[model samples]
Target: MKRLRISLTAQIFLGLILGAAFGCFFPDFGSQLKPLGDAFIRMIKMIVVPLIFSTLVIGIAGTGDFKKLGRLGGKAIIWFEVASALALIVGLVVVNVLQPGVGVSLPAIGAAAGANAAATAQSFSISMHLLNIIPANIVEACVKSDMLQIIFFTCFFGVALAHIGEKGKIVVECCRGIAEAMFKVTHIQMNICCAKLFENYK
Candidate 1:
């Protein structure tokens, strides 16, 4: 007899169904579990910048040809834009259909925060958004989680890294290592989240 084991998908589906039942029966206890959900989300977000940078840099650097990299970048940008637009449209449709926050009341933000947001909106433009992808300070971009700027910088860095020949070999290898580590980290985080989700049942 094969060892009994549940597939990750089935485990997740089970967790969702049982979690809903648990929450319904224990509302106050469920409310205290918000931080687990938030921590899981935060863990996922933490992986994004490093994983993207490392994988993209390795991939672009591996191409070893500026002309080919440019074409690949063009296709990637097109795909990113189309996929993003479609995701936005689908998300809006789902939110409208579900009306998930329909009855929720949000606390008022401070006037200063509102004013800053308004000013930011007033100053924003398509051209500015495009230009902002070239970071004045690459370190700041990474620290702030400015993905576009980071990607823009990574493309250039990858091209330069490739052109450096022997010197770039170590950097490329390091990126490959980092990418693998991040993949493992992501898998571990998912398992941890799954265990946390199911732990209440026991």
Candidate 2:
């Protein structure tokens, strides 16, 4: 007998197909798996900040050019704005074209849910968001898992590390190690994630 191997991509694809079929055949059971889905998302989110911080710090430090970093940051902001605008336009066009919500009756959410939603809506402030990105304390930002703050702090730290020259190489190397470890962790998570998602649906 010959051994057969399945690549990760193929395994993930198989999982997706299986999950979809299982969900369609057993909608009630599939709906119960929402908690598991959320848990998996949380697992990935836990890895994201550290991975981003370590990798970006290493990248910015390696370049050792503030000008280059500034340019990169500018381009990133422009890309985000452009992509967001395009997404909004496309979404509006699609919704208008399809009129998917027409004649659709949605279940009314609970009073508590509406209250929470209103509270969330009230919390939006552009000035506050910009201030938050600067993060008064890096430790608090990490604890809160505030990505913008983490990125802001990491970029500043990287530039500072770069300015120190030889003294900072040691730190950069350490960050490189952290980045590699995070990558490995993410890989392991991905392997388990597909299996776990399938198991949940099953």
Candidate 3:
């Protein structure tokens, strides 16, 4: 019974069975539980910016060499671009070979105003995604929870800290301590969240 009580996998399995039973018997009731799922996701998202900022700052400050950081950054960017281009080329090749869209009866291009609106929204989303890399305001970037900007700022700040001589060592040590504490906290929270999620399912 103790083993049963503490086992997360068992709790999750039990929860899934119960939830499926509930949905099967009471669709409307199950639908109302959607908020629980959304709340869990939101909770996870709320942790992102701080976690990234702390870890990045610590990593950069601890490095002790600006040239090493620059080399790492350059290599990372090059690898990212190469991987992205490869993915794109592979997708295009596969799509051309499969031609899944060729014979499918698509909705008439001009028929649906709603479809056009959706397409426009998608385009806007893509454009915003690209533009968001440029920080409007540092505070806004942090508040909006932009991971990339937070990482960039933290890394740059860390490098500056490293260059500040004796004073920098104290700051770097503090940042490292903070990063470790935050990591531990994050880990504990994740375990708690997972336990709760499993319990809910059970």
Local distance difference test, each candidate: 0.87, 0.86, 0.74
Candidate 3 regions with alpha-carbon error over 4 angstroms:
1-30, 78-136, 196-202
lDDT of 2: 0.86
Best by lDDT: 1
Better of 1 and 3 by TM-score: 1
Q: Which residue pairs in candidate 3 collide? A: 15-201, 15-202
Which number leads on TM-score? 1
Per-model C-alpha RMSD: 4.3, 5.4, 6.8
Q: Candidate 1: list runs displaced more than 4 Å.
A: 16-26, 95-118, 196-202
List where candidate 2 sits over 4 angstroms from the true fold. Answer: 1-3, 67-71, 74-78, 100-126, 196-202
Ranking by TM-score: 1, 2, 3
Over 1-202, each residue of candidate 1 has an lDDT whose tens digit, in order, gives 3445666677778878877987999988888998997898899999999999999989888788878878987998899999999999999999999978888999999999999999999999999988988999988998899998999999889888998998997999999999999999988987777864333221
Better of 1 and 2 by TM-score: 1
Better of 1 and 3 by lDDT: 1
How many residue pairs clash in each candidate at the backbone level?
A: 0, 0, 2
